[model samples]
Target: MLQAHEADIFRPDVTVLAPQEAVPARRERFATRLSPQDLERRAWKRRVNTIHVNTDVVVKAVARFDQMLADLADDVEGQCLVVPAPSGAGKSHLLARLQMRPSLVPFRDEVGPVRPLVFIKAPSPCTLKTLGLALYVALTDLELSATLKEHDIWRRVRHQMHAQLVSVVMVDEFHHALRGRTGDERRALVETLKNLVIPDPNDPLRPPGAEMRPISLVLSGMPWLRRVLKEDFQLLRRCIFMPIRPLGHSAACVKKATKFLELIEPRLGFPAPSGLSEHDMVQRMLKASAGYTGRMMHLVKKAAFRAIRSGAPSISQLDHLAFVFDEIFELGPHRNPFRVPDISTCPKLKEIEFDKLTRLMGTAQADIDPDDA
Candidate 1:
């Protein structure tokens, strides 16, 4: 289970509106409109809410979806697919983007049925039962009952699903069930995947004469998932592994860094933004992030209040690096003598001025060339 502290601690969920023409008024009820701040203090929520800012990652996410379609197009026999990346790699962000994006086409037009995208996170306190519950919930309002015949439940859901074309069921954090959990939990999880991504759904449970819906279960998690799967009996063989490893950020991401900075401003209770240049913002961010998602998120967050307070239209490269260094998650635990319980509220030394970072940091100009000090 996710601790309360972990919930919305890193990011907030955001809603982006597509062009009005693209959305129908009634269907638009599902729309989430994000304010500027959602990307600031609650950027982690954005992990489940925001659009993918980084294009390369977006393409990869889409590509992964396409791969899922292709694999299941012929045979929906594969075990869940895994998208694994390192801690700072932004796996959740990518997953969230995919979750929020609307269908490229409608669920149906004049056609008989179309596939709908069904995305879900595996319940942390998840089990085979919980997995069934998730699938059940996604399909309809049915109560979770072990006694409910699997095929019977599917028959009902399958009928519902026929109204839509492909239902891509995305399960994030597959590794949680795979590693370090109890054996029963693992087995339960495996069974859940089997029942969910069953090869065919028409004739009932998997045997020679059975038919199944070609549901795609994309499971994502930390990089260790690949290794974790190796130890499992049938899982490693059935699933195709998609490494969610971080690609070095592109010049394009840094090119207009101001967009990200402004995107993060509202999260920190910042006022509306004014004039800002993209070049400087991107440059500063690139330096601070050194190209890691977790750190990048932090950098965006830390700069919010500062950028707002200064009335600067854009966060300067200097400011970006300073915040990134100060707030972003380091590759490992951070250690610095200047660090305090809360840098914002740390008591000023007797000789130092609050506004003068130099005296606050107890360093001379030569010793601290950076603006962060």
Candidate 2:
């Protein structure tokens, strides 16, 4: 369980502080006198830090996914895992966590040090040559010869993979490869990716000195990645499709959401406790965030900042959140979850799907306008 004060905050330099030091330092800073604008700025900065609320469902899913990757690593089978989710559903965040596992670290081998994992984002206009070059750069930190043909680029990539002893390759934003391409182009791109995991036995690029070991692949992207996989039978057969959906409206989901709020409430630096776990408040929050974990946290963080700027001890009622939602989203009272007395009864809430809400909320930071700051 991650306490509110122990939550990871984002730093401009991207250096993370130890939890013990960071929490106290933050509390001390909040205690000092400052201008209202500065206070709001400081409060808003907390948005960058992730509050990992470990619900049973999320924990089990991550554990299962990790176990699958681990199994693939040991066998070196050219199997793949496809993780598809709507934006802000935490797909990227989850991949970031997986990259930190000790099992994925480099280790000593008879030959030398062997890197077990390599993570890279698919190039914007993803092509065989560009993708190969990206992998080459990730492996050797050197540019591939632009003069080389696409096949030659892949040859170098294969050689480097053997040299580094990479067991897993995680490609994020894989959907970029399929964007704006013809059917034939998409098919060619899929084939190129397929060869990366399961190479042709007759290929001339096979490194002579290194043992042939299978490499596992983990690809993550938006929901459209399913379409790309469907275009290639081999790609679909070689991978496991995992779709991460938003938490549905259910008692279990509400319970998880409530617990998440309880954990975050204490860390907001409130002088007194806020009854955010109350049934009505919890329900309102769930409705506002449309049961998306990322959006839920965004709402809480923004509301906390608003409370601090207002000199309030805690965020206690729907009215407090209503102000922040209206200011951030520019939505009318009828559409704002925080402004409505009964979310279910609100016609606007009933009309919009959770996916649309996820898109509307795009980036939580977008809520903070520069002029307002």
Candidate 3:
């Protein structure tokens, strides 16, 4: 179900190593045993990669995606499931989990190859031609010419999708389709997308009056994807919008936040576990992370590493988080959410230079702040 794109794409099939002790070999017959701190440095790297805390929102998203695919199987009346969320809401991670489901894996039965689902990340500077090519490559092993016309490319893409028995086509980072475009361009893109969900009998792409097989679409991206649907009345009518809500300062949200903290605490290498699930720590974490799940996990990962580097027994205090926040986010103590006396007065991350933050973190800006202008 998961397809790899050339740029700004996360492969679902990538491996995550398990945590283990490290022993370096010295001279012959001599093996240097690593200290706990030395081993933990390497162990935490592997442990963090293995972490995936599935909260209720993630569960519901996956359930909705599954139901969409199921409905496609029965009726083939292509439906659109629009997942609109911020960059760090774990939209890509949701697609990664869906692709891992065994039932959806491409297989062959009495018929030819059956690809239940196909996933592709929408290309940067997206165009009808590039989108068609991306989908074409995922559905078949055949190569496409770089100079191919858009109509020819989509003709092949449609053929391949139908031939492969594709029930659902998931496009992550769907917001890219509308970025930095004119009114005419945006309308053109939206019209092309509408045909994917509900083909027009009169459309020249298909033979005249020919019946077309319907394939459900799963489009996940920033909140702007809703704008694409709004471009057409019919497209909006067929879409099921699912927005990922940020953590709020409510009792129920605090409980969910506590569960997430407890889930991750064990994986962070420390002499003893921190009381990350405590009400006070949970409140601070909510403020520090700006209520985004990905940001919360990233903050904790760096805080744990900071504790390790400083020889702290555990990241058990707000000071560690406060320092980590200032260091990584390039914020002073006043602007650092963890350090601010009044959480309400904490500076929003939007006010900061997102590109510089991504540079400081040594991560791709697209991976962390895809929605940022």
Candidate 4:
């Protein structure tokens, strides 16, 4: 089995694990004060064991992904699947599940290991050389010297993908390829990706009449990635676009979002009902989360933990959510949507304030630097 590097760019964002068997144990430890280890274990269990909610958007995106894989089985030349969404819209979570599909699992045979799917994030300052290295790392455990020439690294990546029978290459945060780069650099990046889906015949590695095994590409990033693809007609034509829409204020959207929270509440292990699906609570949640699924889940998780630490039986009241929201965003009573008397009167932000969230969480966002090679 080939192990991916620990760096963010070379590793999958999430790992989907099979459901674990329930362990038989003595009960009645509720009175005991929970230690840090216990708290973390509870959080981990909630994350891994939560039921997967399939909204209309998720069902369609998954169906499209399956179709992409099915086409490969028929020896169809690889096509691109582009999933563009706002930050914290659960795009990475969706990609993670797709990567772990039974059919795409890595396997080995008499020849060697065959990886049906390779997932890697595009590195920040994504030069061709850096992108190649990211692919190489995800494809194999072997360490390659960073001093290798750009073309040389890409040649090796192409050869390895072919040899390993890689059917799909998922590049998460692909918009990194265009950020703060020159027009020429963007063009080069776009062309390189296009060539992956439809191999360039002029390449020295491909003999005039030899069969070229094309690898399908999955490019996922923020909505800006769509504009980038549009700039290059060839790449745009090859792509199947899927967007993960955020939870909105519409009646249907609110109802769906409320139901989603209801599903998650049971998984939090609270003894009492939280009434997360109530119209008032759901509306306040929508504002606090900026209608982003990821942000909403993050808020819920934090509130659950706060309740646990404070010896509350459940995340049962609006105050529980309000306290955590204020703690997370450093907002005053009036500014916190959850605390406000009229949530409708509160000003809405276009997106979740992820920078503040990250600071509160005490984790630096990983942007793989090319120079770190």
TM-score of each: 0.53, 0.72, 0.76, 0.80
* Cα lDDT, model 2, residue 108: 77
Please estimate how well model 1 matches the true structure, expressed as its whole-model Cα lDDT: 0.50
Cα lDDT of candidate 2 equals 0.70
Mark the regions of model 2 whose C-alpha exceeds 4 Å error after superposition.
1-48, 73-76, 106-114, 143-148, 267-269, 305-312, 316-328, 347-373
Find the candidate with the highest TM-score and give its number: 4
Q: After superposing candidate 4, which stretches have Cα over 4 Å from the reference?
A: 1-51, 205-210, 316-320, 355-373
Tens digits of per-residue lDDT for model 3, 1-373: 4554643366457654344322222243475678887896767667765678887777887788778776765663578888887655567777787677776888887878889889988887667777888888888866699699988888787777767777778898887777666667767777777776787777667643446767778888777678767887777788998787788888988888988999998877677778888877788778766576766777787777777767778884665788777777666878777777776777666613444543444423333334444
Clashes in model 3: which pairs?
none
TM accuracy, model 3: 0.76
Q: Write the per-residue lDDT of candidate 4 for residues 1-373, one digit (tens) a residue.
A: 5555546445566554444522222223335678886887567556634546676767887888898888876653678999887666667767876786789989999999999999987887677778889889999977578899877887788788778888899988787776677777778777777777777778664434545767788988767777567767877888998888777899888988888888887877767888888888899888887787767777787787777766666785465788887777776777788878998888775344554664354332333234321
Report how far off residue 67 is in candidate 2 (Å): 2.2
Instruction: Compute the lDDT of residue 233 as modeled in candidate 1.
Output: 55
Ten residues in a row with the worst lDDT in model 3? 19-28
Error (Å) of candidate 4 at residue 237 is 0.5
lDDT agreement with native, every candidate: 0.50, 0.70, 0.73, 0.75
Candidate RMSDs in order: 14.3, 11.5, 9.8, 10.3
Order of the predicted models by lDDT, top scorer first:
4, 3, 2, 1
Q: Per-residue lDDT tens digits of candidate 2, residues 83-110?
A: 8865556666667776777888877778
Q: Give the TM-score of candidate 2.
A: 0.72
Off by over 4 Å in 1: 1-51, 55-57, 76-80, 99-115, 141-166, 178-180, 195-210, 231-235, 246-290, 305-310, 316-373
